[model samples]
Target: MNVQSKYSILVFNRENELFLPLTEFYYYQQKRINESSALSYLITLERFFSWLAKSSNYQGTRVKWSDSHMAIRTAVENYLIYQMGCKLRSKENFQYVIMTKKSPQTINHFLAAIKSFYKTALHLKLYEFQNPLVDADYSISIGSFSPTSIRENKPRLPKIAGTEIPSDSSYRSQSDSYFKLVANDWKPNIIADHDLPYIIYRAGSEIGWSLRDEVVIRMLFETGARINEILELTLGDYRQRINQYEIATLNKGSEKRRIKFLRFSQDTLKLLMRYVNGERKTYAHEKQTFTKLSDSEVIFLTRRGDPYNYNAFYSQWSKIITQAKIKMNIHKTRHWFVTNMIRNIYDTASDGGEIEMKKNELINYMKWKDPETIKVYEHYFNEALFREIHENMAKKMQEYEKEYLKKSHSSSEGEQLSSSVLQTKAILPTEEIEWINEFYKGME
Candidate 1:
């Protein structure tokens, strides 16, 4: 029986035989994709292989030895059509049953996995034939279809087509439009500031509640850190005196490490210390006693004393929100923090220098390489601040005009200036104001 594992991905053929070539490819892809991602790719491969074994186009021949590109292309098209008409029963009890067609995005993802698999196989010399998908574009329009083949009234399925690969700039340009379309309607789900106390209370209110969940929730909102970053925290990362924690990243193959510090509230600091000294201590002690269990230094741990994985943390979060009667996801905590932080900036940043200072602080606290990333967070454009900016600019302009008029009155050019000012009627004429209004009207 095949059991899905996060540490490694396993693929089996229809005959329940181990598939080594694709399994090795999963390991080779570790630097780029995590084990969970690799498992998804392996599953795509497993389904394709299973289909290939039964496909009449190849007469039960292995895909690697199927030299005819036309036969392979036909089989792939048929497989996609098959997938479009199916749905999974469940993750644990896996089987594809008849359902409405899958989305184009999903089919494209499957194509990507299959393409990557073939590329790896070729690089590893596991396949003798040239990659059948070398010229395939995996776009909405995939291949040739007869006039009567597709139902005219229904949504058209993707047809396979051989097209030139898109340039990086062209792809990015297309992606920008897609991103804008998504961004137009998508707003971050954030917990309002007034509701946070109740939510926090609910997080820790349940009977047999783990202190770790409350600590994690508090830290996420206080530090505005990524969920993975919080989950990966260790004992040495925290500084109790400063109420701050250090986040360090060593890239997959890099020797150098980059570090950043994030501070939390004193209240959060107390909760963190409590979890570390109380609940975490118990889990660590249990882990030490169990020789079979690997000792992990992560601050958050499961009941079994194992370090908390993303899935485990998410599951815990789901239950907490359900109990709290809140609809917010865990990631929204970061959004809530950032959105409220920006609101604080609006409250305190009275001058340009102060605004810049707060901007830098935001960038540093978020540990974002690109300052532009802050735009992704939810923000309210303070109407009061906007009006204040226009008022300040008008005041400055008036002050400058007054000083200019005083200078002109005393200077030799005063006669010419005074005559021009008189003609202009206080240096801002009704006609000029009307012109400005007309320009704004054009804009409208």
Candidate 2:
């Protein structure tokens, strides 16, 4: 039999041995319109089965048909707790790991994924008993003294001239206003125009542009979605409306929500359209796609016309940012859009009443549940925009000091070395003591 047929047989055998009704559930998932999501669910369930078989807690004990639910739940909960602990300890070694520093969102995603798996396992009668894992509460302790302790333990680097000072307030204000302008300008345009986004794409392509990069940048700018939300978009998730686009899906924490894009540029829509029609369609025809690709049939494709992975997407985005002369990080682009939008709202509102009116107007306009979210973009308006100015100043000062030292040393070499050197050294004063002598103190 072929590899796929052999694999299917193995999976079937395992399913039967485990007494899991996984095949039917898998079929149900594949039948959903959002097949990508169905596939992810299946893959997660498959992992659950694999973990159940290998788990020390589950080994040798035959899962009674009635105890299946309890067995699966207990297995999943134990696995999640073990994984979370492993992640926390691994943080010291893998500092760049994104979720190393836990956030509410990160913890929630982890819990939700495990919770969903147990719920599905229970439904499928994978075990004989109700899932014990379901009864466990997800809790994390953020130590009260942790932040201050960490700060104390961390080594501080000497301040260098060119490095920008880390001022959170200033950065936030600037970023908030930058994107508002871009979004409002494109609000009146058709999404199919394809000019603006293409210009951005081409300009950014020196680093590299994949189909997903094009779609992501466009979506962020057009829809004002967060980077995580943009990354989550799949082909089946977006719906075109009369004047806007509606993205209906689960966000980071599996919370289903709808976000509306009022004025998607025609350019962005056309690029996405072309990617779906040309790139993704061709990949599906070739049948060389990965499991994720086959399941999602997403709009954005890799150069090989497969579904885009996060690492590859980030690498490409970093390259684009460098090529485009954009001094901001990838997430900064999202900030750029939001900041500009808020600024425009602030500017267009009536005088004196501007802040109050604009705040209320944006609440309705953007459907923001909390006005405090707007504070993230406030820095752009508060300061001047300059690149490497402080760094340059620092370098120049260091150079001047070096040149002065060189000149002083050269002059000293021409005279009686010890006396002249000491005199010349005194020309450029420093706080450090020149010499220490027990007997010479009174004479000096």
Q: Write the per-residue lDDT of candidate 1 for residues 1-444, one digit (tens) a residue.
A: 996755454656667887787777777776565443555576676777776776635555544323565566556655655644433232221222223435233454465566677667788888766566555332433334344332211111121110112223322332101101111122344444757745656665773467888777777777777676677766545522243443343222123333665667777777777776677768674433222324235678887778787667766777777777767656577767877787788678899799778978887766554465555452444544577799999998898788777877777685766666685577687889799989999999
Q: Which predicted model would earn the best lDDT?
A: 1
Provide the global lDDT of candidate 1 against the true structure. 0.58
**Model 1 alpha-carbon drift over 4 Å, by segment:** 1-204, 239-258, 286-296, 321-330, 375-444
CA shift of 40, model 2, Å? 4.9
- The reply for model 2, stretches above 4 Å from the true place, is 1-78, 86-105, 124-126, 136-217, 225-259, 269-366, 374-444
In order of appearance, the predictions have TM-scores of 0.50, 0.40
lDDT of each: 0.58, 0.47
- Estimate, for each residue in 1-444, the C-alpha lDDT of model 2 and write its tens digit: 644531221234454563335555555334432333444455555665565556527555744323554454344445545643313222221111123322222233333334444455566655445444343332233323233222111111112211122333322232111001111110111122224445567766655565657777877766655555656556445543444345544432233454533345777777766666665666554543232333344555566756565545666766766676654444445445556666666668677577777766655545454454454344444421333466677898898678667778667645545654686578655533444343468687
- Top TM-score hit: 1
Q: RMSD to native for every prediction? A: 15.9, 16.4
Q: Candidate 1, clashing residue pairs?
A: 142-159, 142-160, 142-161, 143-159, 143-160
